[model samples]
Target: MCGIVGLISADGPERLASRVAAMNAAIVHRGPDDAGVHLAPGVGLAMRRLSIIDLSTGHQPMTTADGVALVFNGEIYNYRSLRAELETRGYAFRTQSDTEVILNLYHAEGMAAFARLHGMFAIAIHDQRRDELILVRDQIGIKPLYIARHEGELLFASEIKAILATLPCRPAIDPQGLWDYLSLRFMAPDRTIWAGIGKLGPGQILRRKLCSGDQSIETFWQADLTPGPFDIGRDYAREFADQFVAAVDSHIVAADVPVGAFLSGGLDSGAIVAAASELGHRAFHTFSISGDGAGGDDELPLARAVARRFGTTHHEIRMARSDYFDTLDDVVRAFDEPYGDATGAALYLLSQRASDHVKVALSGEGSDELLLGYTRAADLATLAKVERRYGPMPRPLLKLAARFVSPDRASIFRAMAEGGPGAYRRGMAAHIGWTISDAEKAAFWRGPDMVPSFDLVQGWYGLPDTAHPLAQSQQADFGTWLVEDLLMKADKMAMAASLETRVPFLHLPLVEWCQNTPMEARIGPPGQFRTKAVLRDYVATRLPDAVLNAPKRGFPLPIFPWFAERLRDAGGYVPISREFHNWISLEGLKPIVARACRNERRALEQLWGIAMFDRWCAVYAD
Candidate 1:
């Protein structure tokens, strides 16, 4: 709903408001309607409001009479109920604002109140009573919060660019973060590309004391994927349909502003549009993206089919190869970090088009993670089983085999052959088409040898609670990729257009049910695997067979040819664009670009990730 920034400083309160003001200026695109700041002693808090809930009086930096101040971003779908409960307990609200509800809730329940909030948010509370600054990210990381430190001062913001605006100088790049971005296309949740700056992970809370300058971070909630018993005879498809409809309705009705949705021809978005129509919210806006030359994969016609079925206003943003190139700089600037995937650009343009008609849009993002939707789930399960049977393919053999294959197959072979603590991470990197190997890394890294990229998913991969390969893979993504990469992309891209995006599938009750249920309800037995089987079953009658039976066509853009052409025109190798470019040797990227120019699509995918990183360095490495 807004962009937030603040700091607890060692230096006295001189210019505290001005310093926080400058930080707020960096992310004005996130909140263009209203702005406010509160200063007390060594603490300063500020927010720019987009005004989704109570348009007239939802101004932020809201404070209670006892001197507790708060600035919040994102919406609380259950706030009206919470406010009614508080009113019965003798708490009189001054305005019809969720911000006031949060302020009062904190006065009543302390930190325990955060667990009761059933919505996406990044909140900062200045409780002078305890001299504490408490920061909380939502249960699924639907919102983002980044923190940085200089001297003894602590700063937090909704985006990294705001923190960078307040810094004395540019922070050094964290080598491991770069390695993770190159290998996995996103930074891990615990660290950003900058060494001293970090982000709060999903379901996490941080407490910092102003007087003593002490801090601690802890997880408040996480997905529990331990194998549990469920009745095999129960009608789970009907149960999922009912719950999903309720969740979508809850998201649609929460806003005072008009709510729209992102419609694709695929199963997830189609189901959301069907649910919204069934719930009687008709004539609402829906947005989709179309590529000029993308054949068979274009979902625009299918989106039009859904729109006609539902009687909704449909808008399609037509993009060409030139549009992809034109938006490259803006996409890098929007994320404020290195991000590689092409689908994010689609969402960015779609949200921009939707923003002209609606302030909040519902997206079906977390369904794939909740249910066993991705084909990679099956591939990973097969790899795990093969690893148990074959123990590992030897490193020298993998190295020798790499020469005979293209970069894409070489990464998969390395993943199949790798063992030890980082095996799962290596396989996941290959799953996403990262072609870099340890041998290649040694040749590319100009300084000391890079650490194993497996550390990127350590502690998140191979959780001890579940032994099922499918459950383990889902849990790993729930912890790492779901929060760190996918959710970050959704938040940044949507917020860039001053629009709020809510993921109905991530509603806590729905997520809990999917996580606790047996995997058989999602994907069937090993011999009869079906991706997102329950979801497909639920939407069987509501959608057309063409949509119901189509394979997963994820926001296809002609980016491979685009990346190949650019790299080829740049003479088949582009140098890292950072001010300090001694880390990665340009000579090592020659083979990848050469393969891409030869029309190896996977090689171009790897280069796309590298190109995004290089663009990020050019923007931020000053």
Candidate 2:
């Protein structure tokens, strides 16, 4: 993995280098081992490398013989195959790096190359001869890329902060982006934390010709949800197991570095470890984390079991309360946004320690979203069916009941009444978006009228009308939450530790095949989280029974008590930043906080989210 920055400007190459260097510097934690820059007439490309593949020889800002420059972040698991294809086409390679393959492949295929790639990547390619610069992100949006067009320049980077570093002034908060976060704890793939700077959505590309100053942005691919006949009666478990092995094998292949797995002891990561070990020649290196005194089901023991089963060398990191508090600043800084996923703190620390032992690690992210794993998917599906029948409670009634009723019920009612798009948004907000209500959202923002996050999801990429309840939920998240929240956390936290984390479940062929599979095999009953039903069946015999049956507690953090204690110590609304002080209203949540402290423990997620946003602003909003 790496930090990549590119600028399309009329400015001199010397001036552009300094700006791109600063942008690259802001995200140095992403790639601290090596740094390089390439300058064309008016375009500049820069990258900081972590040296994952071809460790001794792969220095990026890698180029073709005739001077087409490429700066890429994330891995191209299928690079070996792509390189072989190019070799047959009479292309010569100078380094054993995917960077060289991508550079040459783009030269061979141009825009068509994205379709052939099969891994997570944010690519910046500058064609000096054509005088055009293009920035592309992977089809699954597993890697993030941000773009800004200002003063006759198109600026792009792996992280938004890198783009921000080149700017003269801090960009204003995008109100829509804030609402997107308030409603979902993440911006839509199309929105960034800042107003003017836009995020390049998944499966999309931005091509800017420096000569004409004409830029074209469009999607190159999408989730192939086209309906097709699938048979569940067949031995799907074995088929899925075979596919799992293939994906894990591809993700774990490294030239000089030891590839490892983040053994969460969950169904997915554990399966990834098993597949990596069984399919590859290398022994697995596994890592896990625990809280020192904050008590809960420590996954260390379960991870140890998996490690023993796989014959992998295992390491664990334990974090105390102070460690959690101390890392909050760094956590938010790493994300470059107010990411409220509390698990990120733990993952950040785990990655920090894990990086000490290895450079690349395989994670089992993206499986739940693909396989209908999130309990919310089943719940939303039920709500969708019910909405079709009785419809939802009236809006005014739901609004009136907002305080008396749970935020979840209010959101359910809102979705039932609105139907279609609102269902997923309401369900997601109630569960993961800190359960903030519409009324609370109204009070949270003090800018232009806010857009509901669902509108963006629906507009940008909603499921087909033929998609089932489970499929609807999965596809919606596949576009929004999976990209913005889950994958964002996975990428940033791992990169923050200068570790390259690859997700086997996110492999495109696997995703496409699974998405087209029968919904019965994908999910169980509503809200039960029988996600990846077939997938689990596939790996059932491979992983320990303990891991298979253990309840799906993902990166379980005792976050509520921590936030509650902090709140009691403060005696009021905790301020995260000047913006948090100014824009986010406490009037609506005051009673909720008191009620939470008394009996309603679930309300503390919002408090925790507020504290997280505060820490982010404390670091970046300046």
Candidate 3:
């Protein structure tokens, strides 16, 4: 909803305000409605307000009478109740703004109160009396926060570019981060492609006591991955449906400004729109992003149908390959990294279009991760069973099949043979991502530190921590794929367009409800193999048969044909750049490029990934 920036240092308050102004200027798109700055002896805080809540009074660097300044970048869905509690404690009223409530609550409870709040927020609170800076991100990381510690100054912001304003030089690429992206298609959450900068993981808090120049990072809350008992007979589906509609109602009502939704023809967004309309909420405006047969699904037809049925105003934006290519420069720059997901390109354009009419938009983002909605979950579970039974393929056989089989399948053959959680983890990434085999990757970097996709999150949310294979994959995704890539892409694209996108599915109350879902309902029997089975059941009657029975072609941009055409148009195989030689190896790059030139679908992603990284370098590095 807003862009928040803070720089705490011995960098003289006078100079700090000037530097903060420049930094805040970079992210004006995030909050074009209003701007404010707070500067003191040891720190400066800034925020761009979009004017969503309490439009008359909602402004930031919202300060209290006691000298505490708060700059936050999300909605606290439960702020009203939290306000009531604070009022009971005799807290004086100022504005009917959540920002005021947050400052007052922090005044009452300090940083410890973050756990008691539920919302998608990136909060930076500066306590002048304490000379302390505390940064908090929501439990699921729906909002982004990047931090950098340099030359006795600590910088934190809603986007990486704002942080880059203070240090314009491109940060060096971390070899480990590159290796991780090569394996998993995304960098680790705590790590970014740029060196000397770090993304604060979801549910994390960073506190810098400027007096002592001491800082530490800790999780304010953690996911309860412990499976909840799924009872189909106990009206749980009805409960999920009711709570989900309530969540939809809550998100739309958060803003005093006109609110809209980023809708798709898919069941997720359709379901939300229907729920909103049925709940008799205010006039609903819907937005959809479609593709121009350039490796993307055109959901306009169905999106229009749903919007019409719900009696909501609808807008559609169509994107072509050329459109994507043209905007890609800005897209990668917005990413500030080599994000492998092309959906970011479409999302960037979509948010840009949506921002024209509305300031806030609801989206269907976390549904897949929460409900095991991807079709691959069943295959992953099946592969795990096969691994458990046959004890994996021989290494020689895995290598032999690597050249012929799909990259995902080849990974299963290789990783499953190794056995245990690592295999399952690797298998999960293989199911959804494109990466070369370990043997193939070794030719690029045989360093002792290269982490395999299966082992991407060994210490947290990796395969070893969960029971079911589906659960294992979900955990891995929630930690890596969702946090590092999907959420990052969503935030950047939306903020770049100056639209505040909210995810109803990620509402903690709704997520906690889905966490109790049974494995059977998630992945189900292969013949049926219905993903999000409980959710499908809930919407079965509320939605049209066309929607309920539609195939899941989520953001299905026709990228293979586009990649093939791009390579052919460029005079056959694209050559790897000198940067690739510096980081990866010509030894490994040769065959991958060769395979892609041969029109191998598996190899296309690698070539595209390299090109994306180069494009990012073209902007930030070179």
Candidate 4:
């Protein structure tokens, strides 16, 4: 519920304080309620507080008598229990803030204490006793943290912009990070768009020995993707329902302020609202975004239906095509890193509306990746089976036949004939909607080096070979796409509005259970092929019949029509900013723009991706 920044440098305390103040100023939107700075010789810790847990006395950078100091950005749901345990151990607390709980827990257990936390956080702890600085991100990366070292200074911050604020100059663009963004629309957790900066992955810890200036990073948690034995008679629906409701309760109650939710037409958001209602949590606010019929489902009616069912105060934000263009630059600037997802713009607007009513809002973000919610999972599984049956066929013939297919289907057809690592790479590329093929990439990409989507995590595709394809896809996405793209978007867009958004589905307990769920339960029967069958079954009675079976329309934005309109407005040419002149090929983008102007959907999508990247360069690179 705040933004944290710190530096371990050789600068004098005055210079350190001044630079840290500038960093804090850069992220005032993240924590407008309060701000604090702490400097100790060679180290400085700073934070901008949103003031959710302890408004009056939770001022930080909180320090101990022994000189251990902490600046934290996030809420710890299990703090109350941890506080009671610490108090039993004779540890005295001066405030009821979760920040104090973490500081005390660190005192008692050291690094092991982080494993016991059950919330989203990015923490910076300066241990004068150990003469080390420790930085930790939450288990699922629901919060964000960036780290960079330049000219003998070690810096960490909640957002990249904060780190950039302390920099003497803009860092060069990392080509691999840009390629990853172009291939997948987001960089991996370990990488950022800037060359020298690094992002802490989920469940990761980075420690710097202030004395020697040595640094090390390690992961403290990982998804248990290993499938468990299925007991057909165990009533998984009821079990999932119990834990899910408990998670909803946990997230909704953690904040002292009123909590609201994002309720789209999709089941994920709808189920969150239903769970809150069933638990007798009444009068809480809910928010949703409806389209102006540019494209995608008009989610307002379904959202209104759930609101009426729960009798909660519901707010709706309507988005038009013009809104996308108007706020495109703001959304790009908010990310700092180049991000191409248009849905972020929608969420940005929605979060602004929610901020009028509540400081914190809950959304069902991690459920789809945890459970098998997207059709791509089933499609990939089916593709694997088909590939196995067609393994012996001539590869070149299939490649030739692929040329006969439409541009959209060509890559998928080509991917179907390849097997092993190559197949997974191409399949993943297609899964993430990569509009540029390997052949196409070779033609136009002038960047340093391009990374395929599957290579985002070295040797990730080789793991858990015995798991079902569905399980593999689910696990892969949980690590890469979910943390990097979806959760990152959620954090940046919501924070841009100064609204703290929580994801109940990403609760560690629920995530662990869902990750180990049987493949058959995640996707429905063989012929019906429904996604997220377990979730639907769990909410069958709790949600309205219409919502129970509603087809999933993922935070869809009318990017296709929007891109076409943008191209038409620009006289059928993609506007390439001078910032990207040396990075991407205008000659290579010509055909894509031409196709977009003709209203080709995939071409339009690709154009949207490039256009967003252009805007990002204009904002950040310029």
lDDT-wise, the better of 2 and 4 is 4
Candidate 3's displacement at residue 15, Å, is 1.7
Q: Which ranges in model 4 have alpha carbons more than 4 Å from their true place?
A: 376-384, 387-433, 449-454, 525-528, 574-576
TM-score of each: 0.91, 0.90, 0.90, 0.92
Cα lDDT listed for each candidate: 0.81, 0.76, 0.77, 0.81
- Candidate 4: tens digits of C-alpha lDDT, residues 184-214: 6676667898999998888999999998998
For candidate 4, list the clashing residue pairs, or say none.
none
Q: Which residue pairs in candidate 1 have backbone atoms (N, alpha carbon, C) closer than 3 angstroms, thus clashing?
A: 1-74
Model 3 residue 283 CA deviation in Å: 2.3
Tens-place lDDT digits, model 2, residues 1-622: 7888888877776788788788889888888899999887888889999887888889988887776888998888889988999999999898999888888889998899988898888999888778788889999999888888878888888888888888888988877777667656666667777888888989998888888999889899988543345564666667677777888888777446878889876888888887877785456689988886446567777889988988888998877877888888888778888787778889998888888988888888888877767754556555566656544456566556545766555555555344443343434433334356556667555556766654454443355434444455556677777788888898889988889888889897787777677655566333444667878787778877888888778777666666666667778565756777666767755776785565355567665666666677788885
Over all chains combined, what TM-score does candidate 2 have? 0.90
Write down the RMSD of candidate 3 (Cα, Å).
4.3
**What's the distance in Å from true for residue 88, model 2?**
1.6
Q: Give, for candidate 2, the lowest lDDT window spanning 10 residues.
A: 425-434
Q: After superposition, how far is residue 359 of candidate 3 from its true place, in Å?
A: 1.2
Candidate 1 deviant stretches above 4 angstroms: 376-435, 525-527, 576-580
Residues 186-225 of candidate 1 have per-residue lDDT tens digits of 8876889999999887789999998998899988887876
* Candidate 3 per-residue lDDT over residues 75-116, each given as its tens digit: 989889999999999998778888888888899998788887
Reference-based TM-score, model 4:
0.92
RMSD of candidate 2 to the truth, in angstroms, is: 4.2
